[model samples]
Target chain A: MTDAIPEFKKTEATKVGITGSALTAGIGSATRKEIAIILAVAVLVIGGLEFVLWAYDVPQYILPRPSLIAAALVKEFPLLLPHLGYSMVSLLSGFTIGAVTGMVMAAIVTQYPLVEKVVTPYILVLVTTPMLALVPLLILRFGFGYTPRIIAVALAVGPMVMINAATGFRRTDSAKLALARSYGASTLQIFWKIRAPMALPMILVGLMIGSIFGLLTTVGAEMVGGGFGLGNRLTTYSSMINMPEFFAVILLLSIIGILIYVIFFLIGKKWASWET
Target chain B: MVVKLAVRNAGKRYDDLEALKGCSFDVADKTIVSIVGPSGCGKTTLLWSMSGLHSLTSGQVDLDGERITAPRPEIGLVFQEANLLPWRNLMDNILFPFEVKHQTPDMAWITHLMDRVGLTGFEKRMPRELSGGMQQRGAIVRALSLRPQVLLMDEPFGALDAFTREEMNRLVEEIWLETKTTIVFITHSIEEAIFLSDRVIVLTKRPGRVHADYPVNLPRPRSLETMAGREVFDLMNKIKADIYGMSSMRPRSAAE
Candidate 1:
């Protein structure tokens, strides 16, 4: 008699009946389909552009075809390698210094309100005025070398990182902090264990934004004064009317920017998965 | 019986507003005491003051005769929500108290507590992956991990469904028996207060004060059947009458 009612079976049926179809739509397969669509659209667009340029008989110096740009990339790869090396070195070193210092400053300022009040106005000034505008002045003092470019890159990245990181550090849930205090957790312990981990997602966002800004400033500063770098190469190629090689350097910079974005995206996905 | 905890003339004023006014109570060792009050009656404020999370504007809370001005290691608090660290797994969240204290946790005891709370299989699960009831269960276990002499729970089961809340109430009774920890449980439900406590403290609204302290003489190890008995019903009604009587006397009809 009890079994005839089928109470448990009824609940089981209702549970699957509502969400079964939607849940079965696999995320992996959906993502793969999306990637395939994107690849097909890219092929069509680039291939169409190549056909139009070829049909019109555009001169290589005036507007290189997609094929010529590809060829220039392969042919000039050996010559462009040293400049790529120089740009990456300054970019990475400056970014490392900027990001680390920004995080440290954010932690300190947030912990000490008096210090925050004193330092915030200067940070705002750095944020509003383009650090690239200071590149010529930096070059005047430090000469046309890696030193000026690195300084400009670091200055450009620092304020961006500091602002985001500071906001993240302050965004910790008050309830969690109260819980920590109830356990008699010391200030340092609370900062490191509770506050820092909670701030990581925001900190990652800052690093992503800072890295892009750092790359831009590195290129711009190199264009202003430096004799060696991809930015310097861009200036040289354009001055000599070497259009294919100029476009090739621009292509390399685009690839580097995309790589930075993808690295941070993967890091956020792996480390901050619990946020969702 | 010895006084394990005491709240002496506790009062709190938020500038012009008085939250709690001269509210006082005492809990004997190894006993369950529940406090029930009307809305805005400062039940939570009293609980927070007792936990030493904050101080009363006047008066003090003492545990084992030592005045508590700030949070101490001897008392453990279960918040209104599970309040689990989202980034941490259940096991890591439970071990947080030990991390704060710089003390090594006993894995065997932790596993045992998890078993007792029916969270034995969920140690590695993240907080977001667990159900609300499961998260609350994990919180109860975390509070018990430190082996505190007194456990102060602020509406720990308030967020759960009726069935899960009852299950948590049962778990609380069972844990109290095994560990013999003095507990101060606060709630809005009169039946819940009488069902689980040896003594139920009732507080009035606004400038909250202890209106009555009623003792329950129900037999040990109470079940759902025990709660449905005539004696339990009478006790619940008596407390309800006291609360309703106070409501009628209010000059303004402030709905709860």
Candidate 2:
């Protein structure tokens, strides 16, 4: 009895030790060295782009010289800050509203049968097609103000969140659900305990998508008619043929977009890393 | 022994497919009963029906005279896979049933069960951070922690190797002797069935019905040496011949 028992325990202990160390090693964010390498590569790309433009001396309208754009960025820095802030408010607000409504709808459908019928058809039709075409109608209704623009952002962003989150809710393991049921957990308890955590990876995916779509739609909204924003600057400077300022605004918009993706990427590593 | 769990004329149909037909059996209190049959023989269906995880198309399953319709807290089930939640560590996973039931966890009991299953120090480890055998050990101890009146195991060690399977059988035997929890284990291995069970219930192939029931009448604390005994070999051969449909090989008593 003692012979087999000790050997089994020793082998089992070693097996667990290897896997436990492997888990901590494999999970979480990039290492500090890796982060440094990424940062260095980004600097090289930006500097190389600037150097190429300087060497070429291209005409400003076709493509503003990097020096000019940077100077425009510096000159317009104070001015661009307010406009950038405006676009962010709409993007963040609209994304939040869409995400909240989408998750709420998903929760409702996963819980109740009838609510899915009411919500899914409308969300699917709107989500699958470009809702930007409907922006003109919204503009007509809401008068080119913050109302139409934010509403447009919500319409564009909400459905992906709703669809993915609902799908995620459905993807829970039947065995786990059975375990929960055998323990006499209520439907609400199962939703919170089993369904919700399992649905998180999908929900994060939805948010990542929603944030990207929100940026595009909000920019489209600003282009259509906004009092102040990077998109508004794009229209103003281009029409006036202020190439450097126009190019500078585009640069700022790209930076903000990259920042949103990085945020979600880190979040994915933190929470959903175990999925692999 | 008194009847603890009873399946009465239980039948199951999935749409057009009938998986079980008129299957009936009774498990005596505190005894280990094993069900073995050919593949796709509704052994799982019968077990699931008894667990109240699936609704039977006809007839009823009862636990201590009460009809089992839905999942009850005292009815514990061990699936073939450990099925531990990946996001939770071993401690949380073991404590999950109590958390769901809103009952305070008996920490002492959980630790004791974990020690019994040789998982005492791995409590803080995540499911993904454990080996397959370790994970299954944690799962078995979890099933035990529920302090269930009857534990229904569906091929609990089916995925393990021969050596690990033997270890698990021994672990289960020790737990049963110590706790006296009625267990209805389903398996495909005839040797395993004969070795672990007080009585073995053999079933007919798909649309399964009870084919035969034989009491082991073997002594307690049985070991691997028991499998080498002539009586055990004769029992295994008889059960195997029945399962394989070699009717000519059915055991005739030496006297007869």
lDDT of 2 by residue, A179-248 (tens): 8888888988998888898888788888888888999888888887757777888999999999999989
Best by TM-score: 1
lDDT by residue for model 2 (B1-256), tens: 7999999999999989889999999999999999999888899989888888899999999999999999887789998878888768899999898899888988899888988888877788777667677778888878888799899999988898888788888888889999999999999888888888999999998889999999998887888677899999899988987787823355577898
lDDT of 2: 0.83
Docking class of 2: acceptable
Candidate 1, superposed: residue stretches over 4 Å from native:
A1-31, A58-63, B244-256
Candidate 1 residues B1-256, lDDT tens each?
8999999999999999999999888999999999998888899999999999989999888899889989988899998889999879899999999888889998899999988887876788777667778888899889989898999999988888887777778888888889999999999888778878999999998789999999988887889889999989988988888788778565446674
Q: List the residue pairs that clash in candidate 1.
A: none
- Once superposed on the true structure, which residue ranges of model 2 sit more than 4 Å away at CA? A1-40, A65-71, A110-122, B246-256
Which candidate number maximizes lDDT?
A: 1
Instruction: For each candidate, report what fraction of the true interface contacts it reproduces.
Output: 0.63, 0.48
